[model samples]
Target: MASHRKPRGRSAGIRTTPAVGITTAALTSVALLSQSAQAAPAAPTAPSAPVEPSLDEVKKKVDDLYHQAGVATQRYNSAKEKTEKQRKKVDRLLDGVARRADKLNEARQELGSFAAAQYRTGAASETATMMLANDPQGYFDQNHLADRLTSRQKKAVDEYQAEQASATKQRTKAAKSLKTLSESRDDLRTSKRTVQRKLGEARALLSELTAEEKARLAAIERKKEREAKRKAEELAREQAAEAERKRKAEEAAQKEREKEREKERGGGQGSSGPDTGSGPGPGAEPGSGATKAAKVIGFAEAQIGKPYVWGATGPDSYDCSGLTQDAWKAAGISLPRTTWDQVKVGTTVKTADAAPGDLVFFYDDISHVGIYIGDGKMIHAPKPGANVRVESIYYMPIHSVVRPA
Candidate 1:
């Protein structure tokens, strides 16, 4: 009975198993294929957005470089002018030395003629030699003088020749210096152009990025601009407050001065006594010289309506250095052309020690100079796109004080 049951069960299982196995395998393959198709990532249909530079940033770069190049050009020109002037002086010296050498040669020639005359007179036979003799003593008696004269002339010629040689060497050196200066000027010009081109290229790069990048850059720039504007406004307010303070102080001082004058007048004749000491004059501090006070007054007087220039030292439109030079010139003191030199010429003074007419140098390397107008303030041509105005010294990096003459 067990054997019969086993055989029947086996038959039944075999009858159903082949078709079920085929169906299961087919379904499994279909599911695997579907999964494979879904799991394989497709190639990116579209590209990521293109990056771009900020237009405003590029423009700012252009302006900054342009301004810097302009300043460099002005400095180069100033140095070039100085070099050329030195060259001219050297040339004049060379010419003078050459003339001295020529004069010595002429003296030598005259002495040679005299000596030849003496030789002819002594020889006595040659008629041409006799005619060459200028001496009434037939040249023989004056032979010693002729010989001495020739020696002196030769010595003079040698000394003059040496001087001329030195001058020639100096002229060569000066010419080389001039050449170097000219080349430097050219290089500065070329550099200016290259920087300008770079700025333009940066601007051109602005178009390459996507809108998101552009927006990010714009946001950054806007934040920076807002900060700068806020700083500017704060500075303006500070300056206005300072000005107000100064005005109030001046008004109070004026009233006090008037009261003193009135009291002195009311005291009757000779009651005020001899004016022993000069008080601190207007816009001037005490413990300073009358000459300094006069200089300050002179600068203040000239400040009425002048046009500002970036780097000009001029008789008309003036820059920082120009105004200082002209102002000191009015005070009977001469100053160097550039701000750096001007700054170095004066005695260094602290802000507390700064006197009227003391030159106030600002910016690194002493590039900007102005007249100290008392109260830690100065009048100067500030920068490009700015005018000649009075401002606090705290607004800038002060270099030092410069005395005049």
Candidate 2:
């Protein structure tokens, strides 16, 4: 068997994104492709059926499913990375085992030659002749050293034994690596099925909503956006105030420096002396960070409107971290592949302190992330059915802010 362990299962909410392929993932990909909180709706219910969930309940349910799918997407990314790395290692191991097998075969051939040479000498039993060298006492023991193992037979036996051991060791390692590689692939596939299942459920939910309910759902989303804008404006005010305070402190410090310089000048023509320092100027690093940030922002902007593919990292589509990682790559900085790791890379800062190009993570679980485009907004891939677009950071629960360079 390629693998001994079996595969596992998945859950749901939305299915609008073609990336999930609502029709495809319900089976085949995963027999345990877990149906989300509920089984897919059968034929539309009769007039006397139990009342359907309210639009608001349906909206919340859809959001929850998408959130689960987003988390699954990150898992998929992690598993994919693992699968790729394991594949490379497995390849290397298989090649080494093959080489060891070749060496073992050569050793066997050399042993055969030794047996044939003995047979040419008109030996009674070739097996016994070879065994005489392997088991000395069986033939004649040390007393008949001349009749026992020739140095050539002894060497051939040793070489064969050594080659056999090496090949066995290599085979064991290759098997272990192959097993790990299989497990990683299974993990990747399971994550994918989980995402697809959740998306399918969400699609099913939406499919059942009445036209008026869908419109009402849109209205609810708009209200959320408006609320987000209000929160963003408040954050902007706080940032502006903080900036002014910083400016005042700098002004005071400058006045103090000027006074001290005057004291040094006494009563004569005074000049502002150069502040001599070592290494690259203080502005050098920040200037570089700003430049990189510009590149990152620019790259993200260019990607707006692209579909939100679960694990995509590309010019055409992206998941949250994929988009950020790709954008930073454009700016010449390497970011981790998943939001969990990406959050750990850059310095953490306040939302008010966030600048364009910072990563704004969401949910306490830290499952979602987006590039902060300032003004309390971020450019993110959003959810499955959505596209890469600019949205209010307040649209989701705030986790923490990170300034990924």
Candidate 3:
């Protein structure tokens, strides 16, 4: 009130601003911040596209899948073989069970006839008779007719019971064997499907590559083949050298033994007919094994261009183990249907001691098998696309060598 009256510029010590002025300033500041925020740009985001694998990586992955497929294929082949064998066994068991059932029926008919004859004679049932007779000996002695009838009836009942029991046991065994055969058949189908699926995946992956990539992959394979050939040649040379060294060492040992024998004979010359020692003579012909080997090699060579079919054992197409099994079969030796079983059936030999017709297994799983054909070479039906052909044994990593013949 005092300031309203008259002081020009210095009316009161403190002056208060209007509320509308403070609100207007705050609103203006908020409007300016909103406008600035609207005008500012947003931060950029990173890319979201996925990176593709290189051709080499794809090839490697496909190769791994192919190898896995090969393993599954071998498993399928093994299961198929087992299923076939089990089916045969089950058939034989069923036949035996049928025969036993027939015998049981005959025995039961004989027992029934005896029971009927006893009933016609006004005799009690065998069970009732046995229960009623406190002294069986006295009862039979008093009635010789009953004694003869009961003795025959008792023998019939015993035979019938034994036959029934035997038939039942055989039926139970046949049922279990049939169940196992069914399971093996199912397993075979599963393994087959697994192999097919893996191979399909590998094929699809390979099909996705460009022509240039395909060419590049082919070149890589060629290089590998060349390297394998070089290694095979070197191995052949080393084997020859080793064989020569062994021959010289053996010759020297034989001469030393001959010298010892001569000295024992008072320095007189011994007869030089031939060294009748453990080893073969210098001019001895190759053994029958060599003939069998030749036959195996011949059979394998005859099937040089056949297609490779998984789980196949035939004169047409063959799998890795199938080709080997059939080849040995041509030489009059029977081999199991799969490599896993075939490997166990034969005598294991060293790689250096491997002869023609020897089964050379490859990979750590022993999924692949080929017939060794000398000169560090083997005949094999390689993977799906490959034909039965001769290649270096060292083309793949060797697991072991087995001689089936």
Write out the backbone clash pairs for model 3: none
- The lDDT, on a scale of 0 to 1, for candidate 3 is 0.83
Q: Evaluate model 1: give its lDDT.
A: 0.61
Q: Give stretches of model 1 more than 4 Å off.
A: 1-63, 70-74, 111-305, 349-360, 374-377, 392-405
Task: Quote the RMSD, in angstroms, for model 1.
Answer: 11.3
What lDDT score belongs to each candidate, Candidate 1 first? 0.61, 0.83, 0.83
Residue-level lDDT of model 2, residues 306-347, one tens digit each, is 999899998788999999999999988888899989989979
Clashing pairs in 2: 12-198, 13-198, 13-202, 14-199, 14-202, 15-203
Q: Positional deviation of 129 in candidate 3, in angstroms?
A: 11
On lDDT, the stronger of 1 and 2 is 2
Which segments of candidate 3 are over 4 A away from where they belong? 1-47, 119-148, 247-287
Candidate 1 lDDT at 111 equals 45
Tens digit per residue, CA lDDT, model 1, 170-280: 667667766766776576566546545644555555556568867877787567656645554565566567778988998788777766866878854555553433676
Candidate 1: clashing residue pairs, number: 6
Pairs with backbone N, CA or C atoms under 3 Å apart (clashes), candidate 1: 50-210, 51-209, 51-210, 52-209, 346-402, 346-403
Name the runs in model 2 displaced over 4 angstroms: 1-49, 123-159, 268-287
The residue-by-residue lDDT of candidate 3 on 265-361, one tens digit each, is: 7676555543537655542345467788889999999999999988888789999989998898887889987778889877999888888889999
